[model samples]
Target: MALLKRDFIPVSKQQNMKPLHYPDCIHLSERCGCDLLSISECKGESCSFCQSAAQQELSQREWLSILNTLGLEQQKKIAGKYYSGKMPWKSQQKKG
Candidate 1:
């Protein structure tokens, strides 16, 4: 399922211009519907939660949401190809 834009809370930047640090586990917590707060300190890398989220594929609805963020012309072009069955599939055979 695609998460709505409102699902994410707006993160504010600090006065020192340093970006807020997000725990590598936020994606895992997100699956459980946790409203995460911005953290200033993070545990070291090598987090399995982060790694899993990174490898997950976006759903069709999520892809549509992303396409909607593009300009109108670009959106039309992509949607055209998608609806016309011309969108490439990894295992599709190519003709000479």
Candidate 2:
């Protein structure tokens, strides 16, 4: 009896075989706040539509804007602690 050798490819290399482009969920129009064309040209970190899609549970853009007002160290601290416990919904509770 002869033993046969099997070839295996790693997942990381397999992923590079095809590039992924997600469709625009939030259509950018004159009514929408962001300029889709400009945002598309750069890395999508600051894009509101992309941010909202990635963090579906909360409003990422609003948090990002608030973080921007704080110092870099404070921003890191808040971001690290944000997921540690229940988020304070004081404002939302007051609204109702």
Candidate 3:
């Protein structure tokens, strides 16, 4: 099941930048919290907790969808000097 934007409860970034502890992740529930802040990035393909990376892929897709909503100007401002109009993924697609 794909996660909708409604699945998340937006909290102030400053208030929860670093959580005191990581609660057990419950995928598809409203109680789901951001695990990125507390855990190290990993492939997670073999992690039982990630259900063979399904959770990882779902989270990535959700975040990327939100990012894609940004206009070129907004994206450029965030990307700073590296903000080429063309993304690396687009360039790679052209080469192949």
Per-prediction TM-score: 0.25, 0.23, 0.33
Give all candidate RMSDs, comma-separated: 14.5, 16.5, 14.9
List runs of model 1 lying over 4 Å from the truth: 1-58, 85-96
lDDT of 2 by residue, 1-96 (tens): 212222233448546433333334343333333455644332333444553344443564555456566786765666568845433332334443
Whole-model lDDT values for every prediction:
0.41, 0.44, 0.45
- For model 1, where is the 10-residue window of minimal lDDT? 87-96
Clashing pairs in 1: none
Residue-level lDDT tens digits of model 3 in 12-60: 8666443332223443223443344344432232334543255566765
Which runs of model 3 end up more than 4 angstroms from their true locations? Answer: 1-52, 81-96
Model 1 residue-pair collision total: 0
The positional error of residue 34 in candidate 1, measured at the CA in angstroms, is 33
